[model samples]
Target: MTLRNIKSVQKTLGLLLTVFSSTMLTPIVIALIYQESTSLVFLASFLITGLFGLVLWLPAKKADTEIRLHEGFIIVASFWVVLALFGALPFFLLPELGLSVTNAVFESTSGLTTTGATILTGLDELPRSLLFYRQ
Candidate 1:
């Protein structure tokens, strides 16, 4: 891909990331409703994800190039990869879960893909925010 293509992908992925970060607020609401301490976890995840997205977006915001078919493919593939990584933030940040990096990414990817596979053992014991997040 050329630099323009890369910038286009970056711009798309950044906007997607910024939008996706808002989903974390659902869990924050869940946390507040259930009085769970996990609100901070989701809040932190939201800020980090949104900030990273904004950083990616600012540089290419003015790039008004049209996305070709090849660039579309690149964007789709890269979006999933970036989404999975950023989506893992909350799972990785939650200290009570004690999930490793691999497991956290796995869980995030599984959830995003709707695979329903989990390494976690205790569902009932987990906070509502976390449960809502996984769902």
Candidate 2:
């Protein structure tokens, strides 16, 4: 959509993403609580998501006040895709687990979409850091 069309929703989403970034620290906080190496990973996720969302928001926000249903679906779908990719960063890069990138994205998508499919079998004894993220 043109920048002239969706300014209000854009600003709202921008603010929301910024707030969401703060929650990213939760993983690191939990990791620190359990003495895991999640602090850096969480910090990275926080900054990346925050900056990406922040930049997507432009001053053109005041132009658009309401969302059409079709537009709503597109926005939600695209946002989930973005979140899935970035949210998986910790899983894919952590030296402790070092899971493949594809696998990480799959897990993230499944959890986010609530699809019930999982490669995270045998989670009974998963590390506290990983389990914390799950919860």
Candidate 3:
């Protein structure tokens, strides 16, 4: 992609980041409604990552709709990478969230890719809220 195309892609990324962040709020809201302690972890993560995602979306306001395949790839990959990076923040904050960086990324990718695997064990002891998260 040309420099112009790349610029456009960056803008779209910012917009997507904004959207991704908004959606993340739902889980946080759910946690709070039930007065679950997990809400604290979710709140911290929500504020940090949501603000970061807003930063990603800033350029999009002026971006053009036309974008090349190369630019599209860059945008999509960056979004997912940023997602996984920010996604890891929550796991670190809430270890009971039960995922390492590798495991989290693998599961995220696996779910998107539909790659079935077996590794997660002991669903019984996990709290109801966390179990809902697993689903």
Best by TM-score: 1
Query: Per-residue lDDT for 50-69 in model 3, tens only?
Result: 67666655755566778768
Q: What is the lDDT of residue 15 in candidate 1?
A: 91
Quantify all predictions' global Cα lDDT against the true fold. Answer: 0.93, 0.71, 0.63
TM-score for candidate 2, please give it.
Answer: 0.77
TM-score of each: 0.97, 0.77, 0.73
Q: Point out the worst 10-residue segment of candidate 1 by lDDT.
A: 1-10
Considering only N, C-alpha and C atoms within 3 Å, which residue pairs clash in candidate 3?
14-56, 14-57
**How displaced is residue 118 in candidate 1, in Å?**
0.5
Tens-digit lDDT string for candidate 2 (1-135): 765445655665665566667767777778788887677877887898788677766564445657777557655766676678877876776666667999999887777677878787678766676676655
Go through the candidates in order and give the clash count of each: 0, 4, 2
Alpha-carbon shift of residue 73 in model 2 (angstroms): 2.1
lDDT computed for candidate 2:
0.71
> Which candidate tops lDDT?
1
Count: clashes, candidate 3: 2
Worst 10 residues of 3 by lDDT: 126-135
